[model samples]
Structure formats: C-alpha cells, structure tokens
Target chain A: MSTISLEQIQREMAAAVMTPLTPDDNMRKEAPDGRSMERVAASFIAPNSRLTSFERLEIYNRQYWYRVLGALAEDFPALRTVIGSRAFDAMSVGYLKAHPSRSFTLRNLGGQLASWLTTNQHFAARRADLAVDVARIEWAFVEAFDGAEHEPLTLEQIATLDGGSYLALQPHLQLVELTYPVDDLVLNLHKQEKRQATEAGVKHDEDDHAPAKLPPIRRKPTYLAAHRVDYSVYYLRLNRGEFHTLRAIRAGRPLGEAIEAGVTTARVPAARRPQLVRQWFTAWAELGWICAPDLDRLVRST
Target chain B: MKNQLNAMLLTAALSGLIGGTTVAHAATTSASKTTVKAAKAGLQYVNGDKPAKHSCKGKNDCKGQGGCKSSDNGCKAKNSCKGKGGCATDGSKMPKAV
Candidate 1:
C-alpha cells in the first residue's frame, strides 16, 4: 500500500465529493483524472460491512450537491421564481461548478450570484434583466438581514453635526436602484408563498416544494432601502430623489452636498424640494439608517 | 513546529481561495455567531404597506371606495387599514413614514 500525504487525501476527498453522482457504470467513467470510481472510492473512502466503497463515496457526493443546491435556492427564491425551477436547477449546477463552495459557511454561497447571472444570460433567457434585479435584491436582503450591525446615529448626533461632517449609513442598510419594481414583485411573491402555505397548513420550507409561478412584473423604476431594525428586515420604497440622496450619502458625501443633490434631482416641483428632503431625513433618522462614527478609530487614525 | 507551520500555511491558502474576509472574520469573531441567528430572525416575510389613499376628485367619488385616512406622517394609523387589502402586517407593524 502506498502512503498518501494528507494534502493528497484532502484534495482527493474534495474532488470526489464535487463530482456529480451518476448511475453505477457511468460513475466510474466520470471519476477525476480517468481513475475508475471504484479505484478512487477505495483509495479515499472506507467500505463498511453494509455499504460498498462506491456507495459510501456516493453519500458525500450527493450530500455536497444537495446542501449547496438547497442553500442557493433558499437564498434566491425570487431569482428561482423568475427563471423557473428547471432552469434554476441547471443554473445552480453551472454556478456551483464555476464557483464551488470554499467558505466554511453557506451564507456566502450566493455572494457571486449577481455577477454570475450577468455573465450567464442563458439561465435567465428573455427575463435576464428581471432575473438580475431579483438576484441583487435577494442578495441585498441576505446581507442586510445579518451582515453587520453598527451604532445608529441619534437625532442628537444629527443636531450636533456640522455641514462639513460626512454621514455614514449603517452597514446593514443596502440601497438598491432597480430598473423594474423588483422590490414589490419580490414582496408579492413572498406574500403569495406565505398565503399558500397558510392555506395548505404546511410550514413554508424552500426544500419541500417548488415555488409557485409569480404574476407578470411591470417595468417601473423602483428604489428600495433594505435595512434591519430590531433584528427584522424591512423594505422601504423610496422615490427617485430619496434614492439618489441616500445613494450619495452612503457613498461618503457630506451632509450638505447629499441634501443638495437630492433636492436638485427630485421629480417634484422646486417648492416641494425642501419639504421632501425634510420628510426623507426625518424618516431616515427614525429608521436608524445613519451610523455614528467611532471616535476611538478616528483618534487612532489621526 | 514545521508541521504546524505547514498546516497554518495551508489554511491561509484555502482562506485566500475562498475570498470572503468578512465570513472568515466571522468564523473567528464572536459577532459572527450571533449573525446566523440575526439573519434567520430577519428573514421573516414582510409585505410593504399599500400605497396611501389619494384624495377623491368629487364628494361622491371617495364614497364606497376603501380608503384609510393618512396621518400627518403619510402612513395609515395602526389597525386603520387592516383587512381592507391594506398592509399585510405579518403580526407587528414597524413604524413607517411614507
């Protein structure tokens, strides 16, 4: 028996687990580096009294794909609904093939999905843009839901800040400007799914059944602020002006400049600009979107 | 010591290949553990409140049409628009300003 190094064993285990499982005969043919499935299985996996070597190895292969496929589906139901299940399944296979799970956690599984959807148009077919929008919003939801928490800016802090001060938005707050009203569409789909689950008296689990088809989506420009407050995610629909201003602020613009940019770009009449800005600021402050700068970090950096 | 160093190098190489510093940081930091629960807690489906009712053009026009009077903040009062295709408050309504 040849002594295999730990690296070789780890690499072989990784390779074997990633291979898509097939029927007994075909499994060997698809083994990495033209090695027979039995050969590869015997080299890495130990056979039990009840289970053959190939069967033992098959467990890992099936498990790897199943776990990742389930995670991706859970993360991007709207994307799956937009593209349909068959295409979604194929897309998952292709995506995992292109970008396999390297992280210890499954939360980062769909991190590259937006960019992947951009390049892989075939998966989305005619609804590529809509698919991309859904992917971005869903990913944003994932990030906002549990990405990071920051100290929220208080009304007192806002009062004390000078015009030269730059405001930082909370790390959990994500600003998404979508071409279509994808925010409403995603929300509606979730509503429909929940309603269906209630009616059927079955708990809503993504792995249980295929998501029902969604209604046709209209192409109206929509702005959404996905933020977490008290450990719950909320999607606030923003007008164009509010979106731009918030976008500016999140990009590290000064408070005075961000307000000015929002007012100028507002679709409403000039007379309404100031009121709109005030309303937006009041609402944003209430929602705790602004983050107070860390004085310790500032002092250290200086 | 040499074997330990090699293992550390391998782990570093694997981390680089995976390439999510936040997630890697999360693996080491206590904060990341709380994140898993927080993320799941926030995944509860929340539907946006219905668009605020517009003013009627005529006196009779507003009659029979389901419209909740908007407060000064532009959001309907709590339980004001309930059950009328109003906002689907999953249970608790978050304070929202339209």
Candidate 2:
C-alpha cells in the first residue's frame, strides 16, 4: 500500500488529540464542546483507555510538553524575568508554535530556542540581541550539565607536548561569547526572584509583590566558559586573555602558540608574559581543570 | 469457488495488515511507560490532591495542604465579586482589591 498522505495523517492526529478516553481502556473522542463522548469515541478514539491506552497517551502528551516547557523556563528564567509573566507565557506559546517538540526525549526541546528567539517575529520585537544572548547563556548552562566530561589539560601533559603538539579540549567544555552582559542579568534576576519569595514569606498573606527591576545594562561584550567539575556544573567568566588562550588551545594550537595568542591579546610586557602564563596554568590546575597528557595512549588508540 | 477463496484470502491479508489488536497493545505499552516516567518526575494529575475539609475562622487561618479545599484546591471565595479570588486572613481583603 502507498504511504498515508501527510494531510490525512494530520487530520487523524488531530482526531487522536481531541479524543478523550475513560479508565476502562477505551477511547472517547468527544469534543470538549458539549458533544457526546460516545459519538466522539466511535469516530476517532480507539478502544485503549481501559488497561492503559488513552491514559498513557494523554499522560505522555501532557507530561512531555510540561517537562520541556519547564526545562526551557528554568534555563531562560532571565528572559522570562525581563518580559514578565504575561509576555513570557505568550513568548512560550510562540516558541512552541515555531519549534514543536518532535524528539522522543523532552530534554532536547530548548536547543532551538536561542535561534528561535533571534529569528522569530514575535520575539524579535523585544531586545532581540540581549534576549538571544540570554538564551545562549541558558542553553550553554543546560548543555554544560548534560554533555559528556573530559579531563582538562594538565601541567605534565603540557610539558611533554612542548612546542609542536596541539591541544584538544574535552567534549564537555563549552565557550560562549555574548554581546550583552547576559550572565549578570540572569544572576541578578535569579537573586531578585529569591528575594521576592523571601519577602512574600515575611509580609504574610499579601500577594502583591511586583517583579524586580532590570539591572543597568552593560556595554561591553562578555566571555564565559562552562565546564563540569566533580559532577557539578560551574560557569566561570573569562577575561580576554583567558578566553583567547582557551580558544586557541581548543583549536588544537601548540601550548606556545596558545600562550602567544593570550599574550598578544592580553598585551602584557615581554618580561611578565612567562610569569602571567605560569599563573594562568597554575590556577587552572588548582581548579581541577587539567588532565595529564597521554601521548602514548593517543598513539596506540589511533 | 476459486474466486471466492481468493477474496477470502485478500480479506485475511488486509486484516493482518491493519493489525488492530497489536496496535492497541503497543499504544497501551507506550502510554504506561509515559505514566511511570511522569510519576517519577513528581508531576501529578489535576485530581491527584486529596480534598481537604477544614473551616477557617479568619481569612488566613488555614495554612498548608490540609486547609479548606477551594475549587482549585485552595481558598476560593463565593458571590462577593471576587470571581475566583481568595479572601485574606481578616476575611476583608481580596486578591485583586489589594
């Protein structure tokens, strides 16, 4: 038989959605608009609610979207804070409309939100750049938590690699460059939410807590790095020198070349460059950011 | 006779292709897994909460889950132009009036 037409499938899908089922493994495809559940069931809903069909299907639809939206909101709370509850709800509706959840797993839903915010007409009216930046930071935070881990480069590894060897970062490491001070905005908004919740407790029975005001905007672009350490995610704000060095290292540049990029961008004096580089490496080591070099293992594995 | 036999065979094939019984079974399995996962995630149904039966003296008398049950499972006022708003502890202030 030929594959079902897309239109027919969509109609059938809509019919499935509209149908409600009873507890006895039966389908009740009745419209909510005062229609008889029997007729609706006869037309669309399959006999499935009793043992588990309708109950399970309906539960999946409800919970899948709920979890995805919940995770999205958790990550992009700053965006929500900025727009307030009303607009944020509207924004979520628009976002879901543009990017419906198709994944079997709901954790993947917010991956497209940053791009959606940037390109979608509805979200475009707001501060698009800042909104996109916030979304990016949020996405980075989620990704950092979920992505696989790798041991960072260690001093011993650096010593063995010498001049010509290129360094590769772990898959779990993430670098985000944003035009706005997104991290600061999100942190401030989170703080405000906590404070409001605290104050609401203090005042007793008054539900009129206005949202906290937005912080003063910053002009400079921000650089951020997110990495998993000790099974917990930590985001560190990176300065120009550190960001450049890390980027170079990630690009598989030699240790000397990476430090050179850091030096040039950092504009440190010739005499102090070595000392500065040492300090940076030392800091990274102390933070559990580096893994020992394994050239022999790399050779044997390849 | 041969034509009738061919028609019966065709019907049997179509029934097998449709496979209503198996489709129903598979759907039930899928839905059950979803329910188990949702329960694990701590998302309960609208009707999941047990209705509390407590009469409060003042507006904010009852605090916590065991308080009087409202329509949405909290304090809901009636016939006072409140329109789904809760009365305060003093039974004077409304959510919107504040």
Q: Who wins the lDDT comparison?
A: 1
Among all windows of 10 consecutive residues in model 2 chain A, the one with the lowest summed lDDT is: A203-212
Tell me the deviation in Å of residue A181 in model 2.
2.4
lDDT of 2 at B81: 17
With a 3 Å backbone cut-off (N, CA, C), the pairs that clash in candidate 1 are none
Residues A4-80 of candidate 1: C-alpha lDDT, one tens digit per residue: 99999899878888876453312344585788878887886665545566766665576577667767876787787
What is candidate 2's local distance difference test score?
0.51
- DockQ for every model comes to 0.03, 0.01
CAPRI quality level assigned to candidate 2 from its DockQ score:
incorrect
- The per-candidate count of clashes, in order, stands at 0, 12
- Alpha-carbon RMSD to native, per candidate: 20.8, 23.5
lDDT of each: 0.63, 0.51
lDDT of 2 by residue, A30-55 (tens): 54456654443334333432322333
lDDT of 1 at B14: 25
